[model samples]
Target: TLFVPEGIDDPEIEPGYVERAFATASRMTPFWTEKSRQAHDIQVRSGTFAVTMDGAPIFGPLPGVPGLFVNIGYDGHGVMCSIEGARRLADLMAGDAEHDPKDPFAAERFLDGSNPIPEPMTIHQVQ
Candidate 1:
């Protein structure tokens, strides 16, 4: 659930990123005390910080690639919106629903000019 905003091109995690994560955790939580500075059973995940021009996630079939669907472009809200996108994508793939350009999160919105300008992002940070 760590949602760091920085981007990296390669899979190699920078040592400083870990350092900064520890620093942030220690600052933001009482549980991350000096006694528990070390972490065990770490898991790694890597993915592109994909963003669309309209600042919304895409969930549906690929425009031309048959038998392929995409659930992407969460921008920075993947932590919050991923589950909803998965549900919608499943419905679309199963023929339970159709792509609706009217929905801002729809993948077809880009093709139909329904979503052109980016939506304003609501980013908040703890001091």
Candidate 2:
């Protein structure tokens, strides 16, 4: 679900948004095509704020924090990139030949203070 700000919470009933969306839809140039596949029955929540240094995802063993594993910080690309990311991370943990080096996604990079591009990574907007 898209998290609308407090003022725009009820977009259906909200005056300005209702008119704007109606006008935009009437233009007949939708941004994305409608999906035709059967829906995968699952519950999902959208408020995930995992930050990493390179803005790329971190998907491997939790460094220095032993016994804890993590496959996180895909930013907004988690749904699209998760399949490969999970495979690579699993390979790393299993010490398999297919495991790519985890240097690019090291959690330590966060400590080095390199900021992700297109900054202010939080999805929450400040008024």
Best by TM-score: 1
Candidate 1 minimal-lDDT segment of 10 residues: 118-127
**Backbone clashes counted, model 2:** 0
What is the Cα-based lDDT of residue 5 in candidate 2?
63
Q: In model 1, state the lDDT of residue 114.
A: 58
Worst 10-residue stretch by lDDT in candidate 2? 30-39
Error of 2 at 90 (Å): 0.8
Per-residue lDDT of model 1, residues 1-127, tens digit only: 5566644443666556655777788888867767346676666555557888877788787777788888898888899999988988999889999877567675667776553776666432335
lDDT of each: 0.73, 0.58
lDDT of 2: 0.58
CA deviation > 4 Å runs, candidate 2: 1-54, 97-102, 119-127
